[model samples]
Target chain A: MSTLLAFLLSNHLKSRFVIGYTLILLLVSSALFIFTDNPQKGLLGGVNLVLLFVPLVVSLYTGISLYHGEDFTRVLLTQSLSRNQVYWSSTGSLQLSLQAALLVGLGIPLLLFAPGMPAVALLAGASILSLIFSGLSSLIAFRVNDKVKGIASLFLMWLAFTLVFDGLILLFIQLMSDYPIEAAVIFINLLNPVDMCRIVLMQVLDAAALMGLTGALLTEYMGNLFAILSVLLALLIWLIVPMELSRRSFLNKDF
Target chain B: MLHVDSLTKKFGRLEVLNSIQLEFQKGTVTGILGPNGSGKTTLIKCLLGLCHFEKGNIALNAISIKSEKEYKSYFGYMPQIGRYPENMSIGDLFELLVSLRNQPENELDLELWELFKLENIKSQRLGKLSGGTVQKVSAALAYLFKPEVIVLDEPTAGLDPLATEIMKEKIRKESSGKITLITSHILNDLDELCSHIVFLNNHKIAFSKSMKELKASRQGLTLNQIVAQLLQGEA
Candidate 1:
């Protein structure tokens, strides 16, 4: 498995798309730090960028690369290795490559300018989100064999998680303003990895106070440690469920 | 020995192969002949475990395919169109496959590798190779591991005349002491290379017989004429 993983990672590293992605992240984060006077302000921008950009790029890139490598995957399946090894190694290589890009692209700037718990939180949140989306992409790639349909579905998923879900939650809260629904809203928010990541970053950045009622309710209901732990748990679930589902589908799929 | 018993497969309500039963002993080269969409590929895919079958089982050397993946080590396959990673150089691809197999270097079969002169183009990326060259690569990799059962899908479809002759000679050389299964539209090639031939039509085997039996049954008729007569009879 490691041999396959190393080979896939080498192939991925040589691609122009990955290099361009890494360079874009490096440039954007570096510029954010250099131009802003306050590191916290830059961290705030970084959070939004990570939340908006990371999932979209990771999901699309992983999906497309998997499709492109479909033929090679067939070749691998014929070898002595188990299907689990092939699926995991290919997905692992994609996840690790993207995460490394995130770390280098965002890690350097955060450490150089804003070295604190908030910076660490930002990095962790971004890395976990990248992994979560990679898993989703793998699931899509395995489940939908057609390349165009798979990509379309991936874009829809990113839009739902990042944008549409938040809007629906806001509408739900607005419509049920008379009732005590703080717990329900919080539970619903937990379902969206993007929102949970944002909450974690905001809490650590001391910007939770800016969240108004939601922020106050979050702090009052669940302590800082509990909130972070629960969010991390949610993120972990997001990572495992999709990956496991994809693995099963891949094992049984006809090449 | 390779044994396939009552194998049945379907793809979304369309039956591709129905009750396929076959057996091959060592040193026997069987040609799988069929028209387009006649389940030739599906049958081969079933044998390789690439396509899941609805019923029946396949056993190689008395080991069932459903038991564990260890049985797959005995087989080597060459896909009709070899699609490798575009950026991967031939050397790296060979190294990867060699390491995965973990066979001793001295025991490796370098006959096809040296004959194809792949060493000279070791650094070339797979995407840059011509179709015939890619076919050569697939052919070499299939024989590199010295598998007990070898499957070649359209082995000489895109090759130049010289390469085609070279492949046929290699097949002849390796056919002894190994079970070789080939699927091709070129009857002349099969006539020259295969000891036995299996014909598939309408999702089932039409006939399977040795070359001598087929020739004796239809005196003075070439394989092409024999197969054409069979198809006409069915029509």
Candidate 2:
């Protein structure tokens, strides 16, 4: 597993694009944390970037890496390792490296500028989201054989999760405005990993009111502890389901 | 020994391998010969447990290949193209494979590395290497573990004459107590290296016979001529 991690890092470390992106993240994080008047607000400001950029970047980067790593994966498969071992090692490496990059690029700034529980919670939430999206991207890339199509689908997945899904939910709630749908809204929110992260952070940062009545009602129904645990569980499912499915498909696949 | 019993495979509606049956015993080198789209690669993939077959079974040393992964440790595979991550240096690639194998570095067979002169370009990225260089790397890696079962798909496609001769010599040496399966369009190499030949055509095994019997069956014709006649008969 460490060799696999080393392999991935060796390849990733050579890419100028990854280095540039991480540098940009560092600059953005430092600026966001340093410019805010209140540490809590500064952490919140960073959360917005984590919510929007981390998933997108991680997904895109992971998708491309998986595609490029196809040959490397085949080499490993022919070795003494099993398919399960290879699959998990690849995913584990991606998770660790991407999360490390996020933590180093952003976490240090958060710690230096805003040292508190909210900073810790936000970093954890962002790291989890990174893991979930990297898994999701790997699964998507493996399912599609064509590189161009695989990358396009990855972007589409992120767009759907971040933008289209929420839009549809809003439309649904407006359509069902006459009905009592707080439970349904909470259920829907848990289904999307991004929303799960948002809700979990809201619990930690006491920012649930921004979600309007649905958020307030969800906070009341599940309470802070339940919300955090459920979101963590949801994120775990997001990370595992796609990775397991990808492993099964990869094992059965030809070439 | 390796046994393939009535193995069948299909890609959607197109059947790639149809009830294929073959066997490889110890100390024998079998050359898998086929035309374009004859399912030679598909057959090899099935044996390696990379492609799922619809019917029949493949066993190595009496162990079934179905959902069996540890069995892979017994074999070494050199792919046709030998593509790898573009940015990985040759030295790092070797280290990665050794690490993945979980075997001690001292256990690796460094013969091919020395013979192929790979150490000279150890620091070169895989993407920067030529096709022949990549084939050398693949060959070196395949034989690094000194596995019991070795499969080479067009292993000499991009290799120069010196490298090709070195690879052929290595395969011949390893065939003493191992099962070596090779697929190559170069009939001369097949005739010179293979002790047995398995001819595949139209998704089925046309014939599988020892080189002695195949040579005896056709009086004056070369192995290439015999194979052409066999393929024409199939059509």
Candidate 3:
């Protein structure tokens, strides 16, 4: 635990990118709360910002963090610690720090402007996404040996999640317009963390009017508690699966 | 003491270490010498359990290192290149190590810290230090824990003369009642500090000899000359 804290604290102090990202998050969240009139509008604005930015930043940050910490990782290996300790501490600390950043970046603003169920739900969702992506980044970093390729793959994955996957989903829906594909669409949305998050946020805000066809269908079919809980459960799976993979890969890796 | 038996490691089709067998006894400094890409680092990594090996076993203090981690507590390693967390100041790095080792504040060793004037630079971040300074930091950290086994890879590669002398003195002092394994291309440093020599060539132990044995065979020849002659014979 101390090892994890020290590692994360060291990263927070040394990496300019981390410092800059923290500052940007603070500023953006603050501005959104101050400028917007409707609390729900501000909440939606923050949600959109997080949905767009959190995964990208988490992936890139986790990728570079794992790559840059190679020497430190070796250092830990030589120490009086177990491989499990070293791997988990490094990953756990990075995940915790990123989650903390999300809390401060979005949690603070939401609490200040729109303190309610929406804020709690959004915060939980944002934290889940942060963990999922950071875990994803670490898995990618460990699996890929080359740094350039690793980073490129990470961004590509992010692209697939945020933009390409959804676009492809829409395309699929359009192509199969003659048939009833709502059930299939609901299942497909569960596969993507970003989509799962979007659906959860829509349900929480009771903004099904804006949920499009798939979101409305999911809401109508599953209702709020079932839809949100299942999505939340899916997000947790997203977090745990990649984390387990990266841990195993890291343990087997040669420093 | 350390023992490695029939150790083998490969990267794809290229074998780096091939069924290597070796041992180091307590109270001796064994220097590992080899040509580039000869798996010196790989061997060290295997010993520290940082890398996986395809075959063979390693034992420390007569206990198998297989699926066991507590054995590594006996080792203190300094890599060929020193790389700390970039943003961490020297003090913070030390603090991190202290906490990781779970040692209380009072038991920490400040010998190398004083000898290297590390206190003066405690405020400096690792990223800002020169190569020599980083080497000094690595040396200090490796020696800090006072472990039973020490592995230093190119320990003095980038040090200035004074720092190198200090390092040599430290290695010599620590050589008593402990096993010290070092790897370096600087033959003179090996000559000055090592009691035993293990030469690796073509993924195998070409020869392993005590410094006294080699010296006795070729009277009045320095280690440098002896090794040069041996390499010439191989060529």
* Best candidate (score: lDDT): 1
What are the runs in model 1 whose C-alpha is more than 4 Å off?
A209-213
Candidate 3 lDDT, A138-240, residue by residue in tens: 9999999999999999999999999999999999999999998889999999999999999888788878788688778987899878887888788889989
> What's the ranking of the predictions by TM-score, best on top?
1, 3, 2
Native contacts recovered, each model:
0.61, 0.70, 0.74
Every model's TM-score: 0.95, 0.90, 0.94
Clashing pairs in 2: none
**Candidate 1 chain B: 10-residue stretch with minimal lDDT:** B66-75
As for DockQ, the candidate ahead, 2 or 3, is: 3
Candidate closest to the true structure, highest TM-score: 1
Query: Which residue pairs clash in candidate 3?
Result: A14-B87
Ranking by DockQ: 1, 3, 2
Chain B TM, every candidate? 0.98, 0.97, 0.95
Q: Choose 1 or 2, whichever is better by lDDT.
A: 1
Off by over 4 Å in 3: A3-7, A13-15, B67-69, B102-109, B215-235
lDDT of 3 by residue, B1-235 (tens): 6889999999889899999999899999999887777788898899988899999999998777764566876778888887787887899888878777766666665778899999999999888999999999998888787878899999989999999999999999989988999998889999999999998888999888999997998999998888788778877
Off by over 4 Å in 2: A13-17, A34-41, A220-222, B66-70, B99-108, B215-219, B229-235
Worst 10 residues of 1 chain A by lDDT: A210-219
